[model samples]
Target: MTIEPLLKYMSNYIDLTSDEVVFLESKITVRKYLKGQYIVQQGDICKFSCFVLSGCTKTFYMDGEGQEHILMFSIEDWWTSDMGSFITQTPADFNIQCLENSELVMFSYDIIEDLYREIPKLERFFRQIIEKAFVASQKRIVRNFSLSAKDQYLYFRDQYPLIEQRIPQYMIASYLGITKEFLSKIKSQLILEQ
Candidate 1:
């Protein structure tokens, strides 16, 4: 692959010179995974911060009963990592698995720190990205408390249009914190309303 998507993403926050782009490209390693492959397994150290060039992955936790709870989904152009584990070089609390055949560009911890020191503008870019992730997470928490299940599903649909088609229904149900049967009922009601 091409690093254009990453370059474009960076350009939104800061102007990158040709030399800087080359330097960034040198630090990134591309890898591909089949659907169902685990990028980061729970209890393992997450070695890389992954940027999705194509396809999707989900970060999730497994409860004592072995129920999977989705924490977040990273689609094309999005980044995914166990930030705590990656930064601290500790075991991860979550699992990251590919939901589709995916291509990712990975940056190791050392590479990121080097980038920060070499191109300080990247510090601002990452800071903004982290801030936005935090805000989105906070908004999700607020919506979980404030919105009804059906409304929450609707909001998810609006927020991630076409995502429903890409992933399994049960995964969507899990993400919305609802039973699959409840999600079906909601879909039926929406169909009737339409």
Candidate 2:
């Protein structure tokens, strides 16, 4: 795996100097994970911030009755980590599971402080990333309250056009906060309307 994709992604937010690049190269590690592998399990401390080089993963939490509620899906070029756990070095409330064979570029929590100090622009980049994620989360919450189930499915389809094909229908149902049968009915209604 190469860090080129990561460099390109970073460049979108901040131009990296050669020295910064070299430092990052030395600190980052690339790892491969197979489908069904757990990158970060609930109750485990998340030591790494993972960036998807290829493939997809789901970040989720289980309820008291053991029903999984998917919070988000991370695909190529997206970042995935249990932010609360990674930042505080506490046990994670969420689980990150690979949905496909994946390659990830990871940065350890141990060196992140050093990286921020050495590369000041890196802090701005992460701040912006966090801001965007926060905004998206807020919007999702609003949508869940304001939209109907059919509208929610449509919105999800428009937002992640390729994700429907990549993952299972039941997984999408879970993400949509609906039963698989309801999702199927909504989909059928859409098809008939079309």
Candidate 3:
């Protein structure tokens, strides 16, 4: 895949001049990763912020009991990075793993400041992206506390219809904070109700 997808996605937020685009192309790196490969692992400092040109990835952390709690899933045009680690240059608490053979456009944190300096709107574009992600995260937290498991599952299905088909049910259950069997039962009940 090419950086065209990323450039196009960015256009939805901010227009880039030809010179800015050329500068971006010079600083950006594109890489391919096979399924199950990790782009960032827990405890390692996240050096790059990546945008998916194609395919999917999961960001999660393993608990003390070795249970994995998925934070989010990112597909095409989505951004993935441990923001805390990337911004602070600290060890990451999450691992980002490819769920399919993926192509990503990565911007190194080292060059981000310079990019922002040269392309001021680029910083605004990222700010908006982060703002949307933050709002979604806060909404998810509220949903977890306020909604029943079945309602949460329904909401998830409605919000991520594309994702529901691509990801395994068990992983979806894990993301919903419900057991797989419980998720199965919920799906069955929904079908029966229909």
lDDT, candidate 1, at 127: 88
Best by lDDT: 2
Q: Kindly report which residue pairs in candidate 1 clash with one another.
A: none
Model 2 agreement with the true structure over 132-188: per-residue lDDT tens digits: 988999999999999999999999999998888899999999999999999999999
Error of 3 at 13 (Å): 1.3
lDDT comparison, 2 vs 3, better candidate: 2
Per residue, candidate 1 scores C-alpha lDDT tens digits across 29-122 of 9999999999999999999999899999999999989999998889988999998899899999999999999999999999999999999999
Better of 1 and 3 by lDDT: 3
After TM-score superposition, the amount by which residue 180's alpha carbon in candidate 1 deviates from its true location, in angstroms, is 0.5
TM-scores of the candidates are 0.97, 0.98, 0.98
> Which consecutive 10 residues in model 2 have the weakest lDDT in total?
106-115
Give per-residue CA lDDT, model 3, range 1-194, as digits (tens).
36998988998999999989999899889999999999999999999999999899999999999998988999998999999999999999999999999999998897888899989999999999999999999999999999999999999999999889889998999899988999999999999999
Off by over 4 Å in 2: none
